[model samples]
Target: MLPSDCPISPLPRSAMLYCEIYAEVKPGLFSSEAKSQSSDRTMDLGLAEDHFSRPVDSFVASDIEQLKQAIEECKRLILELPEHSEKQKDTVVKLIHLRLKLQELKDPEEDEPNLRILLEHRFSKEKSKSVKQTCDKCSAIIWGLIQTWYTCTGCYYRCHSKCMNLITKPCVRSKVSHQSEYELNICPETGLDKQDYRCAECRTPVSLRGVPSEARQCDYTGQYYCSSCHWNDTGIIPARVIHNWEFEPRKVCRSSMRYLTLMISRPVLKLREINPLLFNFVEELVEIRKLRQDILLMKPYFITCKEAMEARLLLQLQDRQHFVENDDMYSLQDLIDISSGRLSCSLTEIHTTFAKHIKLDCERCQAKGFVCELCKEGDVLFPFDSHTSVCHDCSAVFHRDCYYDNSTTCPRCTRMTERKQDLPDEQDVGS
Candidate 1:
């Protein structure tokens, strides 16, 4: 509801845009011919309806005719799908996609005012389209068939209003950000959305709405993963360690990261848009220093070898002699700035470090049943119709059967067995 002073009454019959909204915004205020505010204490507010956000007019005849044609063409394509050879599988997929799109267009119940605004942002910069054009994204016809569309003036990439979200790469047409990120929900690589939630790992249907609980979602990408793939409780490191690192809701791996977490090193590289400095640094690590793929993929956020070792995060360190002890974190941002002749550190100490510092109970990566610590088996060896039991202290994931077999103690807990007596020497050591 609006504030107490604002009226809920309907707009008057002759109420035009600005003139009507002025009273609705500030009831006691009056506008002068000069169109300047008489009061400096004017509230910072906006009208419910403004000149920019005008109501859309009813569809004209030509627009309705084109919509009908598009529908007819989609139906025709569906009928032809069966007759074509199996090589034309994309046609079948396209038909299904078109049906979903048509249903969305027809459904008035879908509350997507925000989505509509975001989709229109791409069209805001388009110039006149006097000639026919094809959509840059779907490679579908735009102008002749669907007249109300947009084309990037610089690159001439044409697209339909609904299809504005199919774009992925940096706009060669312009370097401007889109109006709303919500409209671009479809993953450029994986064609999934809230309506069609799918597991990024398992490649199967996942639930976002209408379920006991929704699957874990990526913060950046909005992709969902099945519970079996990404359980929320697998912490392996100290709580502070997990909190120290930066994380986004985006899935970093190009594919399913079987036993990885979304907690990534800052200056994380999107493999497709690799910065030159990062690209060169990676080359030095992989080619010149000959680092393993596993080590490179870890991409620890630390700067010097000493910091990693002191932090007790080198759970999987292969070497110690190669690094110096007292160095600050390697700064990729500084390196990039220096390359542009900003005169940063001329002899930046590039540290070569490899370590895994996450506490099995660490806050970043979730608990996943992988390689049963007791049985030495793989992939969360749970018994039929039961969840894997994880040790709270040690962060080891094992089946209930394994837990019982080990007499209720996690194999990796590293504490003395309950039956073991504390000897005099042990007590002294403890003290």
Candidate 2:
């Protein structure tokens, strides 16, 4: 449809319709103009104008551009995560927990040992031993898991070198403050070069070629003996063997000379020789205290006449205690008769002679021998014998013979050890 005013239009009615549709979809220009712009490489300005001008798609593209920007920001944040800071926070928490546990376990009342200490300060007094060329009074050895050896110039008694607990730092007793602790290369008593020697009791032979220290030649008899053996030979067993009759006397044995030598010598390993009978008596006391057995077994071994009487008195007391506790009280005469067995009168005589030395009451009379179970509540008791139980902590006592018949943990500290559990197929060997 060409108007008369419009110059001759070659377009058909369909082409005009197409142009109108195209302008509606991608507006702002005629189809011919749009095609001319696209062909000229300016892209279709009409299409861009139409896209910007139109209301954005509500259903399919709602806020899609904003969402994409947000997504990109999130990805960047993830890539730049602070991992080292998180790990440091975890480490800090763990360290705090460990410190708290350590604080809880700290014992404020414990005795703190000095971090740096000298050897002589710890082992001040010298211990002695007996050897042919050794000075019994000055011989000492250090005892430890790792040992060092030293030969005393004055006394040939071989000993551990570390036993010289030194006092470089002053202690309450400042006797060793003047001595130079660093002067260890030379022998203190003798000017001879210090050499290491091993005790006959604890000997270890090594190759001579690679010896760490200078080799020493001891002209000492190959027939060497330990301090214990020396004590035994010197009549430490007392009258068990009559000295001269049992062993031959040599021409070197001068009684006066022997007495003088003995006076100056420290009798190492001779605690029993000081008084053999006394040694036995102390041993029995320790045993009876540990094992509350009937004291009658000690009667046959007592060397002194006085000791026999004491043993009889002890047995009589036990018998008296048994009768009284069981409501079968003994008459005074019966008590006297029990105390007057062959050893009974002797016992009385001995007690009367040394009544001042003897404590009026025995250990049994004083409640020291028997413990009250009530005092040791909730604690375990390990019994050495029928009458005694020792708590591993606090040392609160119990008499198993007279009191509770059970085992448990210590009440004071609540310390306990879990024993291995019994299995079903295991046989009871004792039963």
**Against the true structure, what is each candidate's TM-score?**
0.19, 0.18
For model 1, how does the per-residue alpha-carbon lDDT over 133-163 read when each residue is reduced to its tens digit?
6565555555432234555433344566656
Best by lDDT: 1
Off by over 4 Å in 1: 1-160, 163-216, 219-332, 335-431
Per-residue lDDT value at 170 in model 1:
38
In terms of TM-score, how similar is model 1 to the real structure? 0.19
Clashing pairs in 2: 119-165, 119-166, 120-165, 120-166, 121-166, 309-347, 379-411, 380-408, 380-409
Candidate 1: Cα lDDT at 55: 36
lDDT of 2 by residue, 53-169 (tens): 224443234233333343343223222323223322232222223222222223111222222234323322223322223222234323221122333222123333332332122
Q: Give lDDT per model, in order.
A: 0.37, 0.29
lDDT against true structure, model 2: 0.29
